[model samples]
Target chain A: MAIVSGHPTEKYVRIDRLPHIWCPGCGMGIIFNAFARAIDELGIDPKKIVVVSGIGCSGRASGYWAYDGFHTTHGRPIPFAMGLKLARPDLHVVVISGDGDLLAIGGNHFIHAARRNVDILVILVNNFNYGMTGGQVGPTTPEGTRTTTTPYGNYLESPFNVVWLAAASGAVYVARWTVYHVRNLTESIKTAMQMRGFRVIEVVSTCPTDFGRRNRLPDPLDNLRYLKEHAVYKKNPDPREADIIWGKKFVIGEFVKIEGKETFGDRIRRIIQIAQSRLRKSGSH
Target chain B: MTGEIKPGIYFWSGNDAIAEGAIFAGCRFFAGYPITPSNEVSERLSWRLPQVGGIFVQMEDEIASIAAIIGASWGGLKAMTATSGPGFSLMQENIGLAVMMEVPIVVANIQRGGPSTGLPTMIGMGDVQQARWGTHGPHEIIALSPSTIQEAFDLTIRAFNLAEKFRTPVILLADEGLSHLYERVVVPDPRDVIIVNRKMAKDPRNYLPYKADDDLVPPMAPVGEGFRIQTTGLTHDERGYPAINAEAQNRLIKRLIDKIRKRKHEIIDYEMYKCEDAEIVVVSYGSVARSAKSAVDMAREEKIKVGLLKLKTIWPFPDEVIFEMAKKVKKFIVAEVNEGQITREVERASRGQADVFWVGNYGGRWIYPEEILDKILEVR
Candidate 1:
């Protein structure tokens, strides 16, 4: 089996499943590599791992893994994963979804899951545009960016900051990382998985084919360079907005961290005890 | 009749009886939101479940409530949720998922007036059609209605049993009147009651979650098991992979519909009250059945031969029973809270043997027995 570099085991990957269903030079491949490396480092039992994905480019990641995988309906991966996790609390439930799938159609489930603080790991791959559906405008589409739906330049609508939204919605762990920072992204996923409650790792990846082609970065390499050079890191400085063609307000880092007192499972168990006691006392038993 | 009358048979609301029945059936998880008459069901469940080591969660909304129940069911618990018409509308998408994925769940819709939150506190059977075709796609549904509190307890147990046996979502269709009105309910011992669990694949390694066997029902392995099962809303093969071929699609669609259709004999349940040697048959379900029964009794006192065919399982409609009744009865009066929902089914089953008359009340009101009798008298 061909393994992604920096993994302890040579047997975990199903290399034959690739070349993956991703466009050439798509950063999702890089993100997938980072995810595999993170899983390897964790050394979780492959049999106990379930990967759930929704409809989008990132949704296909579940098919690439040899573990238990579910390629579910568009924007429904979270609830599907929640079902899996609730059924088998012993298993590790990890959800991988694109910005459109997680933030657009699935926005309601997203906040409720975060509020419940269910024990699941969520990885959001934001590529700014809906790449799988011919580069339509998405929830995270930047202001004044041209896309199929937002032609003649996008109206300057403030887009959702996923990390901030997750943090505010009571996610136990929230982090933001770009594809350029592969190491940081891998570490964030690992940490999110290790956390006991709701964990969200927001990965800002480049959509060279869709977002890039529309914004004059016709070459895939130039799109990658734009992400790497323009995305301002807290530790390092970058060029001013005048020099950058697109993604002028790029920022990435571990944004917020808050540990929950009790997981949803624990709370449910407690509620069951209370309900049972009440029934017995009322002679309804 | 038995010698000693059971005092445990004191008047109890249908919602309370259902909660007790669910407890007896070992339902450990309940996720629901309060909605008018159905709120009593959730309230009773909330207060009773914890005593037996069960979970009751008051969800932010009905959508989340059903979603949470689905999640809890996967956690290896008998789970349920309750709502009224408006709340039931919110649950259609997830309910469809449960049906398509073959998730064993029980949903109780104590119906009220609708189109949009019509009458919150009053009774209506407006959701009778919604119960059958509310969800998108070709699928099978098992819906039961109870006319009295005793039937509420009994049918709730049957609902869970059918859900587990068929590995499909089962709906307990009650109306506002039945949900809130109190009546004597005889609680049976759990030992005497039969409970069915979803069939588990004997060989975990060879398990195909959606593969139908001779019974046309597939064995299921819960999430914690080592078996890897994939569930999706898209048309899928026996292996649960999305299949687009016409043959695969036809086979899956047929299996989904036929699994319930072929098992109609096992699922069909109804009660015939004074139907023998009757000229008129009143076909009804839920609380409307009570009014129909009263009208039948009143008609019999007046020397009119009228019978009541009270439906227990509303879906996979008791066609065989209805067909048999239609063969003998001169006229069939189908009464309900909605305008001619089940009446249409009765007409089809009757096959032109009898004239089907509909008596319906839509604006959050129950169809009175006198009104039904008047309709019967007019037809006579």
Candidate 2:
């Protein structure tokens, strides 16, 4: 019966909208708190920050955050955030949603946004399965994992290692952490927020109701224990080597961080400047 | 005379006029995926928008294009996107989201043939019905059809103004024929054009994000404006909090529909020609109306009492005008490029008061004046 009320980062929480819909032992609350704490530590103006989320269990985070939050449609947060940032270059836009929402239906947008190096911080909460719906295997679901969609153990050969995909897609900054690594997750979020180009932080979290129960980890806390035991905390592991092979150790760290890169917005401004100059030369303006 | 004409009179295609109109309307953001016919709108804006200190993004797809425009709108920019039939279909669900969120955006669907990517470079008014009901739900939208390249410029500006005024998505439904049709378009001074911006909240604390005023449009506080506004696709109350109940749905949907529905008279624009004492009235829109006008003129020469009614705004139906015309005319010939989309609307409005005949071409071909003149002759 512990409430999210009076939490350290309570100012960022929407007290009116609670109690949240997250299950008793779900790790979304932890990740959500870490995000709030990150924002707090950075002392960023909430007014200048907008949180855009797509549909999922984690998509609900946008509703709980006391900021300019857009709880958008499924698989579309990245594009929505891109538009927001492009419109108001002064505003800090962030996309906080589930792994399935960002990687599956929204995958095209994800890579394109990365390729463009649009300025936005994306916090992907990976729960391995679709939690809002029944236990359904998702894009990040481990091979041989059991779910409602894959009852007799998943036959899918490989699950996407999001960190590698993001890096390969030209993300300026990419990182991965589990909900259990609170300090690491918080610090990563803070860094991503300040970064100018497309930044992604994938937080591997628990889905007790759907994913945890279907697997051997019936209790969500056990899932946390598994993450803590199985994760290898590294500073900058090779993105290609960051895959989670389930039962084997998974590397979690800031995989990529390229500084002094010109963002898509900056490049666009340059394009406009050049085009306007050309127009002036031709006396069209 | 060709070189000495007014500087405003530029030979521009319908699609080109749309882009110029958008810029004149203070549209500072254009995000779209390139599709035929409609692609020119985006291509023109790509360079034009940037020159005006605006942003143009070629998105991954139509859904992203619409999504980006909605985001740009919420970010306090006059935003728009252009697409053809297939792209328009891809944009339906997000368009619904834009409706529910009450985000102001202008989506120009330069319609081509379709059910599934039927014709990429041809004409189709098949999307006339889809323009209204494409997005799943009970929400109403403002969709406009323009006949001339000039109206394309004028109505595209009007579309932005109406979108800003009503805080709803406005569909500038054009066709492949009109999109590519090059004509002399008069671009007005930017100052002469009336541009409406989304009303912003005056006070931070008391500003109910969804609270409609006498005009039925709530003042929007753009994100990053210190309002800390929360907007969602889900049905919400005046405070913009998720309130999923019959009461909330009823109240929210009523305002969403009624804002445009009740103000239909002010929003609806159409042209009627020589309808007095006429036996047959040809109802048409977009490029088809041009042929319709020619047929009406030809019929008049033949002593056939025929008139023309060109619809500028498709949604909100202009029911009163059509019904009024129905009462006066013996029969109405509804001509379009599609089988019989808006014909049903004329029939429904006529309510059996007038005999309705459908003059439609499937796609690819424009409804020739000869065909309409023949229809008028047969009915006469």
Candidate 3:
């Protein structure tokens, strides 16, 4: 999350730890590139934004961040961000993680934080499988897909429609975009960062080293070409129709933008007022 | 972070006292889940925390609860959580996170019998060893157990102090009996209570978040303070970047262990009754210490030279005191709600010079002083 505005992007990169773990042709660089462009566009003080990441291929992104960042356990960055945001209302908190870490092992936290309308931005990178773990079957592993865990076609379960889930769980802003749509994804990130309450942007990315090789698309270019060919921008889209069925059309756009709703922080402020008033009446202070 | 606690004497339950103690210790954030014997802690704080302008959140589960407190602590506030065996088990992973990140937070584990949810409403001392070794890694925890209601209050404030002073996750190890027991507690005036705060990192230009000074603890750069807070579960270097190597691991892990070990003198504490001249030391902690203390008194009346060592801090194991006491004692009658958790520690500390005997059960029933007295007399 190199979101340093008014400065060189290298300011945010941990150059000494260079030659990062991400493989060649992985879409993480693109998503990270878009993420940086977004933070750059916002012009917010780089130090003001804290990025939290769950364990995954994308989770490694936090270690590479120039800003204050926490590379947390698998599927735990959301709650960690919630705690941080609640404690320091002045600082902006963001969760940059992956689908397996966010939806599979960490599925409960994702929905709960969204439901509580916690003030944090979640940039969930979807690599279609557990990329860090070598393309294992995961929560977002499409049905009838091959994975390390599922040698045969994965037919035991269906994938989660991340946008729909976020919308259903009461996210104030929800959107999805393939890494190929860098400009649109960057714009979405800019828009979400400017707003309040729980916001989510699911960036559909490629896992060329693992998921891509397991499938027929071994080359990173093939994966990117597939994403570009399948991507379609939907106007006034319903999140339910936002699923990415393999080798088929998939919708990408801002699905929800119902702003001005109360957030977890707002409710706490109100609760503090009511509670302090009662405390004064009780004279217990 | 200054929350007022009027200096006065009042009857309070262990659960209620911990909630107040946390606020007294300047804890401004609490995230907890509802589990038997520990729900009162979260329930009381639902109103209490907000009253002091502190934040309270009943998180999705035990994992989230611990995670939230860790996050809040890094956000530059004293934070805590309360749970039981089942919840504590769920929190073990993130508890490692707190240890690895060296974040200061408190977790109150009101013990209940368990292998896997064995008894939700009953007592067990099973978590003593678990609190120290539950997380996967080289982890050292500061666990304080309270014997009475007053101790429950005082020890909790001590727990927070230890957490802040060391930048470590401190465990307040109480049990179902202590949690439910009600007794008078003297709340000291806020002006008189000792408070330890984070040694904040200044001069963002030269700040190294994970680089320790002679103290073995690095000064923290809290959120919104200009300096970056970069950390990970992986073995890290002084810059707080991931450095997964033998060299980094050797340095980082040694510091993590030594930070508490070298300073164990400041952290280790226990109470002794009639121990100066006694041959048999009945060792116990938490509510079990109550029965053991009574047994010591009863044994002394019968002319048996016995004493009680009620441990307040259980993690560094306080082996220095045990080692010194072992030279003079005939044996140690270790009592616990669990079968033999702390008994092994006693045996190890004594190194076979003194026989170590255990008198306890994991039946979810409270042990009586007579049981411990029997063991003391048997050892005598």
Candidate 4:
């Protein structure tokens, strides 16, 4: 297997496809690197894992990973991963997509999957704007942030506090991290991998080419430093306080971790058992 | 439970028969959102699938439903989804994706009136054109239309078989009338039925996931089957690697089209009723075909020479059959529940060899035999 030097998880990546299409100083590579490290450290069989992604910059991560990967349509990786997880409960399905792909157009699928507690790990990379489509303002764009669509500053309402949204929508595990917080992000992924139910780890990533350049943070690292400065770690903060304000304040850390509730697969199996017994009693077959 | 299908005669609706047929064809995964005229398919499979050790999921919406089935098919299971007109419209983009990736999955569109939820409880062949041209792309599709409840059962199974055999998404286009109509259907034993699975790569070491054989269909290696497969809707090369060059694009698109087009003779299916010496051949499909067949019988009794040509496989158009009929017949009456959809195809096939008359309306009801007879009389 071809491996890139220095990265412990380089063996997990498709080195033949490198170098990746990510822009210079993009945060997607960092997040993907962290994911590879987490998966590598966990020592899970690569053949048992499936990586699914939708259309966006972050969606490219599925193609870069050396696994059974699917680059699906825009805004559909959650339900796509839902099918993979539901059909073969033995495989570990992970959805890695962008904010625009997961939250803006695919918001209904996101909340519903969380509500049903489908057993899958979702890593949502929020780059504040739609990076692939030339940085249009998106669902995660802060209240006053300027983008190609909101050139004169956004007059729209505040963006979603996804940590709170995921928690309120019944995600069994919820956490938030930044690209700069590599250790914390990797640790959160590792913990979520061992856990069950709908686990969501929102990574606040950067889009220097589109979001940062328009917002006057021309250097991509400046956006990373901004995230490092603003994010406050809270063990169980109110989801309402988890909003990301541009160049200002935000909240991070694991917010929700409630176990013992039945996952979608567990409930489905139980329903099937009950229905089968009912059929047997009725003697239909 | 894994391979045995209960063989018996039962009075069943088209939706129920389709669900049973899916089970008989080894569809282990069904993901769908309930839509009128097609909901019974999902409801029946919801229980049937579990008993057979399969999975049935009622998704949040139709878009998710199709997307999920594609994922499940990639996960090494034969998968299917059911929907009606509006839901089918929502599933178009993913249908195109399924086409692009050449995923072996079945999508049954029990069509109702549409242009957007026009009629929920009524029937229309309004989706005939949409079934072919709805998805935005340059690609060939196979859509099978069924008239009777029994054909519904058999054709649904054939849809799955054809999808796997051709490595493409096969569509079962049943309308609202046929979906709700009940009839006696004799389901064969699972051992008796012919089930075709995708050809898998024998040597995993040199498995090029998109490399085609002589028949233009590549052996499919499902994800997680140790082939470490990578599949995407984007233009890709034989190795399943994304390639953006003109040569790769031409190669991929050409194979996708040729794989089905070259096998049209095998994929195209239809029933010709008394068209050997008739002057008028009424072209129709779905429920309209039933009434057209009756009208043809009535015309024959009245000594007005007419016949019925019922289309079972609607999409690889069966233009050859139409052309043959056009040469033999003096006039062609295309009877459907939508305005000028199949009629346009009949006219195109006729090539001015015969006069073409269209008997269609958006009344959200099955066109009666009397109305079709009137069109036949007008054509005469």
Q: What's the best-to-worst order under DockQ?
A: 3, 2, 4, 1
Q: Per-residue lDDT tens digits of candidate 4, residues B1-380?
A: 23235688989999988998898888989999988989999998987887767788999999999999998887778999999999989999999999988898999999888778688988978888888988887899999999999999899889998999888898899999999999999988777778898887777676778889999998888566667677888899887788989899898989999989989999999988998889988888997899999999999999998988889999889887888778888999988888888899988977888999988788488898999998877769
DockQ of each: 0.38, 0.60, 0.66, 0.57
List TM-score per model, in order.
0.91, 0.98, 0.98, 0.97
TM-score of chain A of 2: 0.97
lDDT of 3 by residue, B1-380 (tens): 22377789988999999988888888899999889989899998898889888999999999999999999999988999999998999999998898889999999999999989899898888998899999998878899999999988888899989888788999999999899999999999888889889788888886788999799999989776668778998889888888878999989989999999999999999999999889999999998888888888899899888988989999889887998899999889899988799999999988878889989998598889999888776667
Regarding DockQ, does 2 or 4 come out ahead? 2
Candidate 2 regions off by >4 Å?
A1-6, B1-7
* lDDT by residue (tens digit), candidate 4, A61-171: 988888888899999999999988887888889999999999988999999999999999999999999888899989999988898899789877578889989999999
Candidate 3: lDDT of A246?
73
lDDT of 4: 0.88
Q: Summarize candidate 1's per-residue lDDT along B287-324 as a digit string, tens digits.
A: 98888999999998999998998899889888778788
**TM value for model 3:** 0.98
Q: Residue by residue across A113-227, what tens digits does model 3's lDDT show?
A: 9999999999999988988777898888777878898888788879999999999999999999988998899899999999999999999999888888888989999999989
Worst 10 residues of 2 chain A by lDDT: A1-10
lDDT of each: 0.80, 0.90, 0.89, 0.88
